[model samples]
Target chain A: MKNKTNTKKGLVKAAFMSFIVVLFLTTTNCSSDGTQIVANFTEIVMQDEFNTEGAPNNALWTYDVGTGDNGWGNNELQYYTDRTENVKVENGYLLITANEEEYNGSSYTSSRLLTNGLFDQQYGRFEARIRLPYGQGMWPAFWLLGENCDEVIWPQCGEIDIMEYRGQEPTKVHGSVHGPGYSGGEAITKTYTLENDRFDTGFHVFGIEWTPDYINYYVDDKLYNQITPADVTGEWVFNQPFYIIINLAVGGSFVGSPNAETVFPQTMLIDYVRVYKN
Target chain B: MKNSKNLYLKKISVVMAILLTTVISCERELSEDAVFAEFGSNAEIYTDAPVGLTDQFFTSFDPNQGANTQGFGTDNNEAYLGSSSIRIDVPQPNDPDGGFIGGIFLDRGQGRNLTGYDALTFWAKGSTTAIIEAGFGTDFSEDKFVVGTKNVVLSTDWRKIIIPIPDESKLIQEKGMFLFSAGTQSTGGVGYTFWMDELKFEKLGTIAQPRPSIFNGEDVVQTAFLGAPVPVTGLTETFNLGSGVNQTVNVAPSYFTFKSSDTNIALVSERGVVTIVGIGSAVITASINGVPAEGSLTVNSGGNFDLAPTPTRDPGTVISIYSDHYTNVPVDFYNGFWEPFQTTESADFIANGDNILGYTNFNFVGNQFANPTVDATVKSNLHLNMYIPDNIPANLDFLISVVDFGADGVDGGTDDLRQQIFFNSSDFVADEWSTLEIPLTLANRSHIGLIIYENVNGSPLTDFYLDNIYFYE
Candidate 1:
């Protein structure tokens, strides 16, 4: 993801976000933790409930096929394929499956879908209600990267991770952001753990509310974390048009390798992905 | 300064990428969550004392065969759970009137409704790491559903052992709650003490992926005769645990619902008894809880059976190896299962309302009686009824051999004696019973241990039936 700084980026987003906050404060609710949650973004610009069967929407999503150079540079073990076995929209859900198989000289296969060219938003609330798969070597994520990634290398273009989960830990998910100096292991990240429940057994909403100055992370209706320029150890690189990428990866630098007990054909189901803007 | 800053940024990019590939990977470890299946029943057998049991739960094995009745009690010093555990002291082989330790924990009331449970779980630790045989589903009256796991090795540290019930659905009211027979076989006949705690039946959902097998999950094909029924062997079930450990337990055939593809050709009962009823091929398969097991029995029936000629020898004068009219002596096995070069299979079955030694794939087989070598010194002649099925081969030379283990009373000893006698092609009558009687010619008949029926010296005898085997004067 690569994006050059725009002169009017901060001023335009600050004005628009405050206007959305004033326009859509009709609903006030208390979360499970008794924290007040006011209606923030109500107008949906892009949404896929996966009500349509077969492949994902062609106009909205595109595939990243085959193993990337050195497993997307993380040494992941699975080949990315657009086959219906790997990814499909069925029964009102989008299923991203990581199967144990031999294809293209890789031991496993999965899918990665991105909206780089079709949909890119400058600032909004992006969330997906997802039920994740479990076991070791399962790394499924819903995140955004700058659309101008070809112009600037990663860490410079910036990345916003709304939800990143290690399947071995069924109860938790991590929210993170990466930029110039604060990237990879040093990225600003926080975790939200569910009580008496697991992400795999049920559907939970993972979202991020982004304005001009800061980003708020949420799992379900509970707001868990906020990251601002002051929180970054490097150059703040969030004022850019970023696109969504949803993927289920197997065995990478982020998740290590799967053991024998890890059952094959793990699946992550997305009930819906809705993006709302002012 | 701009050029130097660009070079520094590039250096950090390379270094951060290295961090991404190595140290970024982390695992959030989860604790063990052993989920038990929800069921209704008093699942506890013993926590500290025997739960839901009468005052005296232990029933000692018969004292006549060296069962030490006084060695079983509860010990409070060691327990996996609660304050006390069942402590058993296994007696040494030289113990007076008691050389072993074993018994059953009988239910004073009616049996337990064990259909809700899947396995009997207990924490066990031995004084010395010794193996024991334990199980349930017996009342010492009609051991109809007895399932014993032989050689359950105990550790020095407390380890939980799970003995899976073959079919819990069958145990609507099971009387026998626990049974254990701990001997000193592994400790070189030396006595040892073992303690068991938290013994109970639990429906552990983690004991999953049941792979029940017959004939060890192999598709075994053989020719069988009409009216002859073959019993299924090697009943077992393997489960993949939550920890990824594969634990296999010996199961009773009653656990499976045996099926014959063509019931007209053959029929397999719930007991896994496959009876050849017609002259066609039928595949026998089994399933438990609608999950198809891996093993199979394919039986190809050979039309009808010709009954063997009945022996007219007087029972008083005969020492029988196998016969319906006389009392057969103690015999070890019908087949020793000598590996590597042996192709003969022993599928002795019940035919025409009586048991028959039906040898199929009849290359060569041995009938061993070495458990108690028959002292046939007073006997004069050996008589056997042999019936050849189908068309007789041109070179049907059946060689019979008798082995006598001299003073050592064991095979392969220096004083062992053997005698081989051949009955040639002219001796057999095809599709009919041939009463062949031979004179006892072995140098020593005092300790006759084994009898072998084989085709040697280029003979090609394949399928045959045998009945009324005895040595008569």
Candidate 2:
């Protein structure tokens, strides 16, 4: 068994090296089409690979506890706590797990991790690789809110959803932008459907290239949607800096309540979160 | 061993050969200058350029005609993109009469095609924080037909300014001037100097057209009592195009064409005002730009106040008093007893096959029957059909109370008896209709009045409809 494991590791390493060589060669040469042949790379501004063990880095992440009124104003049913069982870092990944338990007068408990007051940026490429949780009432999201959230509140503070997946719709994810006029059900959103496999089956890279004039959404390097100021009814408020938030919500108005078929102890594994700038 | 080594060498050679051939073929197609350019550089890529202005005017704003008083000069020291930028010195706010007005006018002779372009992009920096008003017009004269105005803030650091053209249709093949003006009044300080560069028009993809959401007034059901003022005007018709990040467009009543399904029952004005003309039901529809929203309007006759039919009783048999039988008081009233509760007459989940009064615990008050006199000693049980909607929170506790008016004939006079009911018990099934019977003999009041329903634990209740409210043996 030891020999077999070593051989499997060797094979994986060789395949990864081959893929790198191919990408390097293709990116250097020009194609028949008139599309730009420049190398697609940017300077890394911030990154979190979750290489540490135990709790998240105190300097990078903070927690938002308790249930918001009306399920955090979304009719959600989970109590957020700063428990290790709900959020922990291990094996070079961050895990946000939602468990079915009676705690704090809620049927379930989860964690909401934020980067407010720690890290914020104006415009760049915001991305993450995540293995989503699946089952009815499971809502895991990697999104951003304006740094002025405490002062202006939601919608007015602006929100940029890099990736949001619902357990009920296992095969699709949503990218949306919310502001004062275009918030709630009226937010400017676009749906990206997985071609063959569900998002929970494996990790997928979700990214958004945000510029002053436009914001482009991508899944696995494939551009799926783009939004501009004209697409929205209100002012383009993305010019200001915004912080990040990651959470695994157990039942909200967006995902509805879980039924008998829905399983508990659903976990969302995040491989990394990286930001890049030109 | 020699053979195996040779095979491995051959495989490596084959892979290298394939890679080399692909690279050479691609390199052969590149131009001489492109071949020597630095690798992974985006500068050499030939992306699509802005329409009409192929020259880019990287050096200067050509044909720049404006008032000579405003200082304009070309500066090679500060450039946003290329080699040179335009520097303009603005006078102090109080320096010129009628406000300082200066601009750079660019006339292409023939109108440029700005159809695909949504906005003009430029980079600017000011000596101090100031406002720069820029726009385009048909001509340079005073009567020049200005298309739009863009009020942009210029900070000390360089920033990109995107000015959305108000009306693109006005730009089709017309002589136009791209202009900018800065003064003390607009900038709120002394006149300052500014620099601008990289003037171009960009198409930032197509804008998604969002469907409009129309809401008619506050509630789904609109109620107007008879003998009320004609043409009720408080009803508001609102339309939202996007989440309302933008200001919601308040469509005037004149903009909407109103129609009523039964005009004889309710006459609806163009502004969504429903005048209760008769005692009947009508559907009031308010339409704007072909989009329509409907609301049901029920006009109750003033003379007939009872909501339920009279119940028959035998001697010694307990008299059954239904909530719908109250005549002297309004169905929904706030007589300084509790928080106001909105009551709606609903046919859904009715126990007696007619209409039942449904209400939710909003503003802390539950359902209350004002000045209701019931002898709890005779009718020992207060029976009512309570239907809790699925949207209500689970494990919630509710209170049923009977307040005695006593000699004062007012609430909170002497005694009040209250009972608690847990929603999660077997007596209540969420999402389905159920019956609840509370014993009134506990109170046994001489003058039992003011039936009050409340959330015992003070938990928020969304929707709980009740019917067949009565006191019986």
**TM-score (0 to 1) of chain B for each candidate:** 0.72, 0.34
TM-score of each: 0.66, 0.34
Which tens-of-lDDT digit does each residue in A42-66 have in candidate 1? 7899999999999999999999999
Q: TM-score of the candidate numbered 2?
A: 0.34
TM-score of chain A of each: 0.86, 0.85
Q: What overall lDDT goes with each candidate model?
A: 0.83, 0.63
- Per-residue alpha-carbon lDDT of candidate 1 for residues B333-405, written as tens digits (9 for 90 to 100): 8877664367777767666766678776667788999878988898888899887765678877788998898
DockQ value for model 1: 0.02
Docking class of 2: incorrect
What is the docking quality class of candidate 1?
incorrect
Q: Count the backbone clashes (under 3 Å) in each candidate.
A: 3, 13
lDDT of 2 by residue, A94-198 (tens): 999999999989999999999999999998888999998776788999999999989987888899999998887767899999998999999999999876356
